[model samples]
Target: MRRMYFIFLMLCSGLALAQPRIQLSPPQAVVDSVFFTETTTVRLELDYPGVALRYTLDGSPVGSNSSVYKGPLALSQSATVSAKAFHPDFEDSPQVSIAVRSLKYNQPLSITNATPKPAPQYTGAGLSALTDRQKGALNFAATPKAWLGWETDTLRMQLNAPEAGKVNMLVFSLLDNAGAWIMPPAVVKVYDAGEQIGQFETARPEPGGPTQYHFLEVPLKPWSSDTLEVLVLARQLPDWHDGAGRPAWIFLDEILLTQKP
Candidate 1:
């Protein structure tokens, strides 16, 4: 019969290509480059070896004992963690993602809780005389003791705006002496209580290691003040020595001034 109808159509096309392929094994975590503080712990791994594995956070869904995680999973906050795997007949395996952050360290220059009543005066002019690595850290007396002039140096800072809208935001963190120096693309000016309302520059240096820590954001349109001024015109490093060669000390942390209900 024509060789049994060509071997019964090649055994029904080899049982329709043996349909049954489920493979997935890639999802692990342990992330923290610096977020300061919030919470952190995420660990996950899968091959579906025995099936049954579900997860979701920042998406929601995965609760039975709610802590099964076989190998590597930790998350604290600022998230997006996902997972999927469940075979009973095969039909549910396509969702894997891991992204996390949260070490919470937002100091933005402490002013000891200010609402009003004399709390804005730190003057300016290359302010840097609290070393020992800045004592116990955390200091924001309305932050504005500025100084980064080098190469004909001449920078300033003195902002005291307790009220008045528009100034959006400004957050800072920088330390150098071989600790956090990689911010090069100058031109940053935002003075309000002295005039000028905006100016921006800095974008390049995103591959870190070694005393690493960088975070900066600027945006201003609203203005109302008690006093404010910050100017940095930097450029002077022909091996600008430090630790004795002078000129090599820039440490400003958590200096925030916000207004946006």
Candidate 2:
């Protein structure tokens, strides 16, 4: 009987030794990199072979028959990724953790406080041609209304800059008869005395409203005294020909040129 009891004890010991062992490779959790996208993944390598790997998120079991993670595991947010190994004996591995971060537009500045210096004077010929309706519509009460509405219905303005520096800024206020600011493609030429310095094509115009102000910044070599010649012509509407519809009219209240002080 003693011999039989000893044999039985030995058999139980052997069975316990035969049971599968489950362990994590690193023992402690690890992540490849801290900064990762929502699509980034974490890899949990298993140490024991032939054993099923089970996982949990937070604290919930991932479920039986869950795909064995042979490679990196996918994670969307910053959270703990825990896993365990399952064998017939129900051995389990330790849990793990991984951190993640989110991916953002930067907007530009708005134009305000634009005024013309050394104001312009309106020529009598230009002023006399204005119809009673045009004179009544004049917004700038100040003189040198260098701007004039011609018999051809074209409006012209002559401008000048007194100080030298890069012509880094251009600001203009225009009135649209359509009650909306219309940006017509136009060319702006810069001249120092009689010499041409630079030119830029106006592409983006401010949105039309009761009063539209446009601010354009150009980078050019520094200069002190320059005359700006701006010729603005109305563009035909996509489906309508010129002269068939109301003429495109823009009233200039001010044009400001500025540079870094």
Task: Give a tens-digit lDDT track for model 2, residues 1-261.
Answer: 999999999999999998877543322334553333345566665565566666654535555655566667666553456565655644454444333221101011222211221113323223222211112122333323433321222333445454446446544433333333233324445445556555556553323222322323333455555445444444332223233333343444334454422
Which residue ranges in model 1 land beyond 4 Å of their true spot? Answer: 9-11, 18-39, 43-48, 51-72, 75-95, 107-261
Q: Quote the lDDT for 29 in model 1.
A: 36
lDDT of 1 by residue, 25-90 (tens): 433433443232446566555554666666766645544333345654545554556666665665
Computed on alpha carbons, the lDDT of every model, listed in order, comes to 0.45, 0.42
Q: Return the TM-score for candidate 2, rounded to 2 decimals.
A: 0.32
Residue 140 in model 1: lDDT: 28
Q: What's the CA error at residue 66 for candidate 1, in Å?
A: 24
Best by TM-score: 2
